[model samples]
Target chain A: MVMDLHVSLPRGLTLANPVIAASGTFGFGPEYSRYVDIGSLGAVSVKGVSPEPWLGNPPPRVWETPMGLLNSIGLQNPGMEVFVRDDLPFLREKGATVIVNIIGHTVDEYARVASRMQGEAGVAALEVNISCPNIKEGGMSFGHDPEQAYQVTRAVRQATDLPVMVKLSPNVTSPALIAQAVEQAGADMISAINTVVGLAIDVEHRRPALGGTTGGLSGPAIKPIALRVVYDVAQSVSIPIIGMGGIASAADVLEFLLAGASAVMVGTVTFQHPGRMQQIIAELPQVLSRGGFRGVSGAVGQALPAASRPQTRGGDL
Target chain B: MAGQQFHDGQVDARIVRREEVARDHVELILESPALARAVPGQFAHILTPGMLRRPVSFSRIEPDSGRVGLLFQVVGEGTAWLANCQEGERLDILGPLGHGFAPPDPSRPWCLVGGGVGIPPLYSAAAQWRESAPDVIIGARTREWVLMQKDFEQLGLGVRVTTDDGSWGQAGTVIGPLQEWLEGHADGQVFSCGPTPMLAAVASACRGRAAAQVALEQRMGCGIGACLACVVPARGQTQMEYRRVCTEGPVFLAEELIW
Candidate 1:
């Protein structure tokens, strides 16, 4: 209570702690609510939602890697329509700040999904999932290209009054460039980074273990890469950054914050234990007090030296 | 068992009895009332030593005594640690997860086929329908690998055993006798739980003739529906979309299975 874990991001989305349940891992708050008190968390990003109910990838969709997991789930979700009718109400009842993650195969699909959620009562913000394949341009992911990232982010930003946080994929060469493009396109916040692409094969069967052949890797293996992405992107944009990708412990939260993330999201680590967020939240004060920080925001972007700080970006950042 | 595909209640279950079937396979009887809620095909997500929970199927349930049985194969470091756990020790289990098998009509011949590690759940399914005298086929690599045959036989259910090396009742796979039965029988249904190859063979044999439900195995992340790790390709009304094997089913209608 004395540590002041409160973090006020763009669009007035406030959190009780820096550790929020990442999308896909939390599943709109209902799944983990039974094991832990979900209402106490900073925020919970619901699973990636599409225009229609997506069936996702075939069997063997998930493969286990060393200290990580590769999943080609293909963003399996109940469509935006069904989510609004059935799932969103329960999330609202939980009283936790909800970040609805939306994805699309086309720019119109992203915009349409965003617009449909504009009038929703419980949603705190929209996290655009540009990692989805851009069907308009031969199935290349929108987040991989700078122009597509900007166009998709702009479409979603224009479609909704809610704060837009673009969740960028780490597959790109320099996430800083994409972060700059989204910030220029009116993105209120940046959630870097999404899963890194990876592949796993079944040696005994002499074939791919995952039905999708390849998948997005998430977990402890990608933590360093994600930290670098957050560090690089923080200097390039003034927008609040919600950092994630294998964040599991209180110490991990501190690392992301110091690496220039205003708040952090716990993604794949929750799969191991559902109530892990509670432990991290409880232990966060000890971590902050140990590091001589007064609050969660006190640690954001502290790793960057004075000379490395952005010269032009001057607001609350 | 919790009346849905996903439930958050993680039960602390104590081991009441431990039966070692083979070198790596162990059958443990856990005492938990929440387990009484579980049906035949449903499984429990048990916390192992690793970073993820292990999915173990429910072998039997004594509802009145508030006890359930679990079958696990110690194939790795995580399960090996779990298998070594002695009686009176406790396990954190999230149950009664996933959809259980719904038995076909009793009037029709119910063929319960199980191979290798898949034999456990079939025992529970057979015990439930024992009054109807279901035909239980237990298949293994050899007679030494065959398990729960006596359990099924004690219920007076017709038991047929098959082994690959022909060290048991029938030679070759269980599908041989299963195919023979499916071809002659008019009113019958097949419920299979076994290796992927066995299930696939049964599926192909029973295709349009015998209605079947097969239990699938997958490497799961969160035993709850949150992680889309446990999924199988199942055809919906319009398209062949992926269905979550963990949530929508561990048991799916054989017709909808892609392979």
Candidate 2:
């Protein structure tokens, strides 16, 4: 039987499907254009961009350990000007709704980037990245604090007419607190569970493998954590939530939706397979039909009862 | 501008050729028509036991036969599993990826050097530099790891071999042999591939002698440019200043690289 899998965002942006190329995983959209038709999917959140270009961390920046990948890329990008000047045109030509991810060192930096991108054509939304390790703030992360998340969200919300999305970091103690703070500060949506903080040892070198000493761990290793955060944040705020962290298949996407994510984002899996975005987009309908659902939204937050989820260690899987 | 396909668990072909050169490192000539079109320094992502594609460079290309040769060391689980691969067994591979060796010029006398696994690409450079048969130098911990000596000699070129343990050839580092060679005959370009320290030493050794190019190895996700995983600080570029070993080069001008 044919099932309707179309999913729409809270703002006016509607998608043909529910699969989004998570920001930082999928570069400026066109990089994957060769592997798959970009227009065939829902939307793409371009790589994280800051006010100025980032050189990123030093060598040995990424490491793979037991079904997961850890990276300390530090949001390396070509800055806002070049992204709008050189990158946006290509993404626009690809014909897919482009979600621009903006990050900054301070609140004014966030507003400046948002204001510049405010009236830009073809940009579907602005995703504010508040999860970076603040070098100036004595190693305290931006997303770990609710007030900081609110300040960044409010600043971007006030600066741009475009729908503002505040992406949350999983390393935070209370993702719900941060999510609620953003909702109160007028954030349109929330993308939960950026890579959790982790590290690896190079045994041979007798030191941390990543040049940054610690990195954001993604892939299957963080899938359960992502699911839990999405579930918690969904219960905390009335705003829409885009769940992500190590999504590998359509089944994985279903897990996020059932956990209360309005939509889902694909990350680490894309690194293993560049063409995975299209495969997930094509497979979502089959997943809906198999579950006896008529549409993708029907699966959102349809988790089993507390007695049914079968308490497995640290909350629901 | 043809379309590209992305699917996991897809193996195009898996006919293996048994060509054992040295201990621990064997030259596997795999049957893959798709990868034969790969350029000089590009690599293929071979499936390791636990990990996905542990990146390996294409040491040489035999287009007529659609066979690509890979020279690898059995250091970790990936290489050990790869080393045990049989002649008829099918191995999952993602192809002709990353960047390859830069195009060689016939007018130039290219001097190629390698240490251990780095010696692989020099074979390809030697095959391409047929006219001058560019001077080639190779070094290893001992005689056991020194490979392709016969292959390099068969190409009718000057070949120098060095062993840190003094078990073979010039009983010293590759730069020692190269220094002796340069003291007498001094008119050729330099091209090297190997471990970072050896390349750095080669870069330092040839400080005022001639131009040198080296291939860098880095941890990678997508062998394509999309992931931005394998990046090295370039010597004299700005902004997008770092060179992606996967795209910009596994190979680069020795002077233009930070190391």
Candidate 3:
């Protein structure tokens, strides 16, 4: 029996499967390739890159919570130039579709980074990161502010020929409005929930656990919130959605797909099992078949109706 | 290149034996043939039921028996659970990961310094550096806290033990003895693993004399480099670079570290 796992967004960016490595959680490829076969996965969403290299946050950058991991890594990368020169060719050689995740402090910075990758031959898509909570400037601000979101999305959309994916944060009150605004600004697709803003404390020392003071919450703790945001934004935007936040198992991926995501990126839990990406991908086929879906694309939004009162379900249609 | 059975992949291991080596600290001997290829300073990551893997250094590895030993202190809930493991209980493990120490140059004198729980990896290295007749130095709060003193002697390395309260071999910090010894072998090389202050002291003593390497410990998430959690500051041209303690090193050249 022939099975099709391919799912794609606009501009013909087709994922060989519905499971791609989440950005930052999977550095371009080398880090994870040491554990599993990078070529076997659908795509690799590399770490976020800026115009210049980012030094990231200080030590004690992470604190393990019950069923979750809080991190304030501040998007550390060797910069766009080094990424293209040192990292890209390696992933391209390994037969992996590389999704370059880019971040910036201003709208111009986003376009500048996008423009830098304009002629890159190996990149499959660009993931515009406007929802990182660890950075002090222009990260979570763009995702929360509708105007900034639209401007950055439109500017980067105009800067490059590759399909654009906007990674959103769950810190905002009305993420669906921001999602609609970006969709209007030509964002080809959306990735919902870039970790909820959170913090932990050391009672004895009276000090914050993370050196950054506050970090993004992920793992099973943020799964429900991620699902809600993805469901809300999925009804508002016509663009394809990539759901994330605390997804570990194949069943979790199927839940996100039914909640209205074309695909799901696995994060936090990947830290638990070194080869979790392959494990999730291997089990996805069985999950789809058991759920009575022919393929991954067909399973998307299976549980959500288009014209009904989704507000009763905690979102609007 | 000890890449014979050394793997970066995860495998299952069983707790073949368990022992309490010091106060609040325990060692678990695991039966995993894959460990035979693991080098001295590399670490093994122990997986729990739901939490992230707890990374512990390879205290001992018997190639012929295909068994490995892990030494760790029960500092948290995750490790507290590990401390109570019954013999024959299976554990999911991923490692022989991370860059270990570079081999000792046979021509130069070798020294191994350890502090508290940091003694394990350096002890593993000292066992291999037997020909150099390396100096083995240990530091702790009291005599009971000092570990593996006899083991170093058994390996034919000269032992120097110290405690903060004058309860052991010396009446000062372990680095004190190492400093006085360093006065003689000005060009010798040293290998060490320990808490931050001990490493900082070693870094200071090896300043212009001995070439040194120190294995670092950090709170880790993935054990692999992906999570970017276990990172330490490294000396760079302009500023400091955050190097992964799990991937770039559990062991590093003292000169490159930002300490």
Candidate 4:
């Protein structure tokens, strides 16, 4: 029983599998190459890149919770120029399907990064990051407001012909509204959702554990919340959804697919087990077959309301 | 990239031995051939029941035996769980990761300074230098808290033990003995580990007197460089830059650190 795991998105982007390495968790490709085969992943979404270099937050950046991780890394990167010069060549050489996750302090900065990535070899798509909770300016702020989210998505859409994915934050009251706004503004896909905003206190120090004080919670703790957001956003938008939040196993991937995510990104669990993504990809087919599904497309949106389920595309067994 | 010869990968190492080294400090020996290439200050990212892997430096690495030792104090839920792990149980570990201490110049007099839970890597360093044993100083809050003293002495290295309550060999911190040692051997090199405050003081004491490299401890997400979580401020070209403690170092030159 051969189970097909391929996924196809808008703008001619097609993945060999539905498992992608989430942005920020997997560095700019080289870090995990020793532990994981970079080319085998469906796609490698590099860390969020800004127009200029970002130094990120201070010390004590990550704290462990029960089945969760809270981090405030603040989207630190070497800027677009260095990324295009140093990182892109490496990923291209590795035969990886690259998804550049773009971020900025303003709408122009997001577009500038998107435009810079234009015609870049091996880049399959652009994931617009408007939902990073760590940064003080222009991150989650744009994601919370539907108008700002639409504007950012529109700018990135104009800057590049590549498929654009607007990452949604779960920190808002209505992530569905934000998803609808981005879909209206020409977003080809929606990656729902980003980490949930949270905090941890150091009782000994009488202060917050993270350098950014508050961080985005990830890992098994946010799976249910992520499914809810992906399910909600799937119902609100016509574009496909890339689901992520504490995704640890192949079974979790199917759950996200059922909740309306066409593909899933694996993050925090990679820290605990670096080879988890590869393991998930290998295990996905077996899990999918066991769940009475022939392929990933068959499982996508299976749990959604009958009237709201989007038309399944790509490989269906 | 230089001096990093260890091939890092995930291994399910079976616990070969477990010993109570000190009060609340447990030393577990695991059969991990992958860590055979590990140098003095390199560490292993061990997965406990917790979400994040704990980065514990190598206390002992015996390549011939295919066994590595981890000496850690039971601090939180993670270490406490690690302490309860019995012999013969397998542990999921990723290592021997990170750059370690550079080989000390044999011509110059060198010393090993360690405090509290920071003595493990220094022990590994001392074992490597058993042929030409350097001066060793191990400090703790109390007499019972001092660790690996007999292990150093057993290796035929002279060990200096210090305690805060004056119940041990030297009263107060390792600074008093360290200052006297620096006065004696001004051209010496110092490799120190333990608490951040002790490292700061060691860095201060060695200024203009002896060269020093100190191992740092920080809460890490991914014990690899990807997460950018375990970072320490370092002197960069124009301004201070955050360096990953897991990759750039758990071991760094004292002068290179911002504080």
Candidate 5:
């Protein structure tokens, strides 16, 4: 059976499949190229790049938990100027659909990064990261408050013509309210559920395991929370949703799609099994067919309440 | 199909032998033709039952037999699981990774200083330089913990054993014998691996006397360079910057590290 995996986001952004390499985990692009065929991924969401180089946190940036990973990497990147000069051309040459995840210390920094990517070649979309729990300021802080979230999303939206995807944080009490706020502020799409704020203690050190003391938790442990957030946000907004959090298999992808994510991003698991995304992409059609869906679009929002099911747009097989 | 066999420097190797070298320490010999290229100071990232892969430096790499040996202590749940693994079981390994120690110049004198689990890679180096007969110092907490002394001696090299409680050859740390060795061979090159404090001490000892290279161990997420988790402070052009241990060097010149 022929299965349609095509995904169309707002502002003319299109993906060949529903599987994207999540930011931070996949690096810029070249890091995982040895393991994965870069051109075959649905989209490569490079790590969050800021306006200036970030040194990141001190030692012990990552701590492994049961079926999960806690990291406080602080969104280390070489800034927009270096990214455009070094990383972009490589991705373009590799035929990858690049989604640049942008972060900043302030609204202006986010805008500056977005504006910098305005005319860059092969940059398919901009994933505005207002939900990174690792940073001390302007990351999840903007995500927790609706007004701040709206301001950051609006700034990025006005900075460039590229499709703007606002990543949501699960730390907030009401993620749907923030989702609605960003939607009203003109975000073209939403990437639900960045990592959840969590902490792990090192008994031997008598302190936190991570150098930042606390970290953003991702992997299979947070999948349920991600699904809940995606479901709530999908019910609140009309924009397309890109779901990510502990996505390990095609079955998990279908779960996110059914909960209203038009596509899914895979991280963490790639560290354990670098070739997982390709396997998931190849297995998606069989999984989708067995679930009685002709294509990804049909699976999108199928698990949501009938009254709140998203009006998904795409060609069904 | 050939491409699939060795994707991302990963290989499927079966454990050919497993030996408990000492209390809480296990030595595993893995056979994988794909990993035959591993050298001393390089490491393998082995998948455990846990979330992350464990990075263990190669104690021996026999390219002719397609065997790589790993000597590690049971420090945590990850190593404990590795210690429990039996022979003949297949392991998912990513290896022959990171920069290894530079080959010793036959004309210059060299010494290998290692403490605790760190002796494995040094043993591999000694094996490679068997003809050169490099000086080897082995450090442990007690006599029971001393590892691979005979192995180093079998390579036609003199072995000096040091223990904290004077239960072994020397009364104190490896520093005493290392200093003595340095005094004799003023133009010697020192290669050391051990806990951070031991490495720091070695770096200090070799500061003005001999050049030293150290292999560091850090908590890593991705054994590859992507995660940026296993980083060490190093001297950059203008200032100190964190360099990735996995990509740049698990082995680095002593002077390059900030310490």
Candidate 6:
């Protein structure tokens, strides 16, 4: 019997599987092609790109925590022009759907980037990253407020006809509100829980571990939080949800699927195992077969236990 | 480029050897036949159970005995646990990952400098450069942080030490003493592995005097080229081209690096 776990997204975007490489962790996609077959996976999310070139943070940008790692990489990347010229061409040669993660300081920046990729041949989708703290704007994070999320999403949506995915930060109080707001503002899909804000203390140096003092937390420590956020947002948003955080194994991917994500992005887990995407893709058939599921859509939201009373916690749905 | 073997729950052997100089750091002598495949500057991915793989550079590979020795300090949770590993216990190590330091010149009077934990790789390079009897400079933040002085002395080479608090050797950073040596020894080759600032200072000190190479310490995920996590900026490159500390090098030419 042939095993099948195909999952589909809107605008005729169909995937043989539901696993995608989270942005940043999988550098432009082709690098992993040397070790694993890139085209077999659902899709490849490229590194985060900006309107202008970014230097990232200083040395010691990452610190390993108990179960995860904290990184204040400051979204280091080549500007859009370099990415299109030097990197994108290489990715285009690889037979994988390339999802570009775009970050911006302002709505105009977001729209400007989207407009550039509007009719690009090889580009599949655009992931709007509004979770970055504006360096010139006194550390204000763009995703914390719904108005900002709506404006950024709306601007990009208007500029490009391509599918738009909004990557949300779990540091906010209400992930559902942000999810719903972006959905209403015209995000084709949503990727939940970028990373929770956290810091690590260096006992030897008697100071904060990360160079940036504070950083975004990824890896196993944020898995449960990511699952909760994905579950909460899935209920509120009509758009397809891309759940991510600490997804490692095939079982972890299934957890996100049952939690209501149409697709799952493997983040910190990929760091632990660079060849993880292929391992996850290879295991999906057996996992789905064991669960008696015909396809991935049948598995979506299937494991959500009878929606219990919403917890009284602040910002929880 | 070699083959990889899968050992399931193998009792990977480990032994604690007395430090030739300092007590804060210990050398774990690995007995795995797999370790024979190690490269000069490549490191071992030590498995310490609760923590992820902690990268420790190969201080020396006893080629005949298949004994691969790693010099490490009691730094984080992984190193702290590694410091306590007793003889006969096994360590889960996936090894010799990344490009090691470049081969040293046998003709010149080379300078080998290390500060604190970064001193590990230099020990191996020093052993390799024994024929040349190179000049050495070792430093730390304080006297207590100073590691492996006696080992440097045993090598019978010119050894200099510096501590910020002035508890040992010189009263300033390694650059001050290094600059003094470079001023007189016009044709020496410089090799160093230490804190970023200290190595940068060494690079700046030897700017036009000598060719300097430094081993960079960046937080790594896979000590292989696979994960782009351990990237160090390269000089003269736009888009901030980086060399993977694991794959490209934990060691690089000082002039080629942006640091």
Off by over 4 Å in 2: A133-140, A304-317, B1-11, B18-20, B49-52, B185-187, B236-240
What stretches of model 6 exceed 4 Å from their correct place? A30-35, A119-121, A133-140, A203-206, A304-317, B1-22, B31-39, B45-52, B61-67, B84-99, B105-107, B127-133, B139-180, B221-249, B255-259
Per residue, candidate 6 scores C-alpha lDDT tens digits across B1-259 of 0122223212255664534335567777777666755656678876664424788888766667778788887766778788877777777665667677677677766888889877767877776657877788888888867766776678786789999899988988888878878987877888899889888888888888898888877887655544455778886444456667877788788888886
Tens digits of per-residue lDDT for model 6, A1-317 = 46666767877777778888888777766555655567777888887777787766655667787888777767777688988888777777777787898877778887888988878777889998876432334123668889888888999999988989998888888989988888989999999878788878888899987766787788878899999998888777778889998887788888888888989998666544455677777777778767766667767776565562222334211
Off by over 4 Å in 5: A311-317, B1-8
Assign candidate 3 its CAPRI class: acceptable
- How many pairs of residues collide in each model? 0, 6, 0, 1, 0, 1
Expressed between 0 and 1, the share of native interface contacts present in candidate 3 is 0.52
lDDT of each: 0.83, 0.78, 0.85, 0.91, 0.90, 0.75
Residue range A1-317, candidate 2, lDDT tens digits: 66666777777878778888888778777666766678877888988887888777777778887878888776778799999999899888878888898988789888988998988988989888887542324123568888877887888889988888888888777889999999999998999788888889999989999888888788888899999998888888877889998788888888998888878888777665667778877777887778766677777777844632323433112
DockQ of each: 0.44, 0.39, 0.46, 0.54, 0.60, 0.21
Q: What DockQ number belongs to candidate 1?
A: 0.44
Query: What range of 10 consecutive residues in model 1 chain B has the weakest lDDT sum?
Result: B1-10
Which structure among the candidates has the greatest DockQ? Answer: 5
**lDDT comparing candidate 4 with the true structure:** 0.91
Fnat: each model in turn = 0.61, 0.36, 0.52, 0.83, 0.66, 0.14
Q: Estimate, for each residue in B1-259, the C-alpha lDDT of model 4 and write its tens digit.
A: 0121122487788999999987899999999888867999999999887899999999998999998999999999999999999999988888888989998988899899999999888989989877667999999999988888988899988888999999988889999999999999969999999999999999999999999999999988888899899999999888888899999999999999999
Tens-digit lDDT track for model 3 on B181-237?
A: 798786889888888878988998898898999999988877778778889999989
Worst 10 residues of 1 chain A by lDDT: A131-140
**TM-score, prediction 5:** 0.97
Error of 5 at A113 (Å): 1.0
- Quick one: ranking by TM-score, best first? 5, 4, 3, 2, 1, 6
Poorest stretch of ten by lDDT in candidate 5 chain B = B1-10
DockQ of 4: 0.54
TM-score, chain A, candidate 6: 0.92
For model 4, the docking class works out as: medium
